[model samples]
Target chain A: MPKKIGSKTLLLTSSPSIIGYAAVGAKKEKQGPLADYFDYLSEDSSFGEKTWEKAETLMQKKAIELALQKCSVQKTDVDFLFAGDLLNQCIGSAYASRDMAMPFFGLYGACSTMSESLCLAAMFVDGQLANRCVAATSSHFCSAERQFRFPLEYGGQRTPTSQWTVTGSGACVVAPSKQAPYLRAVTVGTVADLGITDINNMGAAMAPAAAQTLCQFFSDTSTRPEDYDLILTGDLGFVGSRLLERMMQAEGYPMAKLHNDCGLMIYDRVKQDVHAGGSGCGCAASVLCSFILPQIACQRLKNVLFMATGALMSPTSNQQGESIPGIAHLLHISAFPNEKEAK
Target chain B: MTKQEYALWAQQESPKSKGLGDILRAFLFGGLICVIGQLLIFFFENRGAGEMAPVFASACLVVLSAILTGINIYDNIAKYAGAGTLVPITGFANSMVSAAMEFKTEGFILGLGAKMFIIAGPVIVYGVSASVIYGIILFLLG
Candidate 1:
């Protein structure tokens, strides 16, 4: 059974473990600093597909397949699949799960899709609604570029604040098992809009939501920043991460020492020429699957707060002059199920 | 903090563009593009196509822009060159050609044909409308 914590947080008594996970990345991500962490890296961004959209679908499927294979979990054994991407209508996850024949829940949380899906999947497993579930998300640089910004070959200058959408996919299978890394709790965030309207500065738009969520979790659980080994936010990039640190400091959390963003961890900004590091759903997803999970699994990190922030605005919304609204979903993952409670 | 206060703080925290450096690069690259156009015009004039030199040069530039876009080199140049690449005739051709190449995946009639002018459509619309207004005013003055 799941226990309700203060306000927005939920503590999972079952502590569903992420039994298997995998990350797949394309050329740009391969060139990144965390390149060696990826399960599979392809020099071809298209992934042998005719179109970028189709390539995204294939990449997502490959990630899920790799995750399942890692745990020797057959496709028929999984109970539910939660997946999404940055594509319109979540066609990436839709088409990716089409041939799998699993009970699918399609989600759209922009860059926060990974955490959103993972939180829900963990909840379902915690409540015993499903025996095993898979959470997955993907994003492609080419597909996202054409849809959100300009064409791939369009001659336009990118602002320094603009983030490069990572071309990658990440998938994980969560089940009720005594695995080393376990899902302890989760916090669902409220939308925060501070009248930020700049389309290029997503970090600025999302930082508020991340601060709100992290603050809420800290207050709810009566925990301090020193309690967690790492406080990781998804794809806030350089600008958002700094803003989040300042906001957290103002709230008395002072998490600068403990905090690290998935965006900054995924790329070497200076060497990769990624102006504000990486963004998109895959940025957090791949980093979590490859780098963070492995650390927790090996007991190197005892406790972690993984919160992924998302800017919830479409191209139409931006063009219509609507301000960007941001949301963040958080999961408290730990190496032991009842370690904090015992402490 | 209040939204207004946070916005102000964020504005100050964000990095600003290097104004002088960007302007200098833009000037240099933009001037270089004009030089290429002049060379094309001279080449056409030397071939004795005096009346059609400008037209031939523009066509050659457009074709060169399309080729550069196809080879995936124009955007990289534009990144550093900034407005230098965008203010020239090649930029216009790049915009149209890039859109055409991107949307071609959807289909021919709806995707390529319709979206081919998506980026440059406003420029064409306003340009022709302004020209018509100018012509009307010129006739009235005469």
Candidate 2:
């Protein structure tokens, strides 16, 4: 059973292992640095689908299938599926899981959905309520752009702080089996709004939430930043990343050397012309499943802290002049299931 | 730190626009677009377009904008061009065409037809209303 470590962190004693994982990306992602890590890459941003929304769904479905296939696990073996995306009503996850015929829990944590879903899945497995579960999330550039910002072909300039929404999907299968990379603990974050109202600067909006979560996790675990091999943030990109580092420094947890952001890792900012960096649910999701997990599995990385941050505001909220609230969910992953060894 | 303090710090920490460089690009590209319009007006006038030269040139620009938008090149140009592309007749046409193309998947009536003017709708409403106000003021002054 999962034990409450402190006020915010949940220590999963059972230590659910992510036995299978896969990442699927579109054209822009294919051109990025982590292209080779992705399980599947589609040149067409639409994934050969007529609509961008449908393409997002298809990309998510492919990721789920690839994950299951890699682990030699059948769909029937999975007890539950937790998924979400950036689309309205989480249609991306819903349509993706439609044909799966598994019990589905649709979540909405914005870009932080990958870790949010993973935390829930791990909790369910740790409690022995389910033998196995799948956590998945997806986001597409065109679909998000039309719904949140503007029409795809609209002639408008993106600001320096604006981030490109990544067209990608990532999935992971969590089970009680003893795997190399284990889910050790999870810190569910509270919403932190620093009163940032600029819709173009999501990184700034989400950075406060990430700092809050990381500080809380460190306090709860009685561990410092040096304890982990890497402290990975979801989609804070360049602006948010710098803000987070400064915040962490102020909080006396200077982790400049150990910290990295999925948004920054996914794309080459200079070459890709993606001003600030990449920002999407898929940005962290794909990076975790494809790049981070494999390194952990190979024993290259021993202890890691993965936290995905999200801006919990809709177009309506932003348009209504409401400040963007941000949330971040943290997962402490280790190469071994043994608690003492991890510590 | 307090929320107010953090907000101020974050705002300062975030990157700012390129300032003068961006302004220069906007000026150059915007001027280039106007030069193209002037050239088209000249060509139409040479063909005896007379007072219709400006209208024909505008139509040509709109059509060219629509084509660029269809081929998915206008956005890339606009990214560097900034206000250069946005503050023009071509930008207005691109707005309508892009919205129509995007919402087409939702269907014609509710999607393409209705939302075709989603971006340009507000501009049209205020533009026409202001014109009516200006006409009334002109009549009173005369």
Q: Quick one: best DockQ, which candidate?
A: 1
Off by over 4 Å in 2: A341-343
Native contacts kept (model 1): 0.81
Per-prediction DockQ, in order? 0.84, 0.83
- List the pairs of residues colliding in candidate 2: none
Question: Number of the top candidate by lDDT?
Answer: 2
- Please provide, for model 1 over A105-142, each residue's C-alpha lDDT reduced to its tens digit, 9 standing for 90 to 100: 99999999999999999999999999999999999999
Per-residue lDDT tens digits of candidate 2, residues B1-142?
Answer: 7778977887787788999998999899989999999999999999999999999999999999999999999988998888898888989999999999999999999999999999999999999999999999999999
lDDT of 2 at A172: 94
CAPRI quality band, candidate 2: high
Assess the local accuracy of residue A194 in candidate 2 as a C-alpha lDDT between 0 and 100. Answer: 89
Writing each residue's lDDT as its tens digit, candidate 2 over A1-343 gives 9999879999999888999999999999999999999999999898899999999999999999999999999999999999999999999999999999889999999999999999999999999999989999999999999989999999888888999999999999999987778999999999999899999999999999999999999999899999899999999999999999999999999999999999999999999989999999999999999999999998899999999999999999999999999999999989989757656
Q: Please list the C-alpha lDDT of all candidates, in the order they appear.
A: 0.94, 0.94
Clashing pairs in 1: none
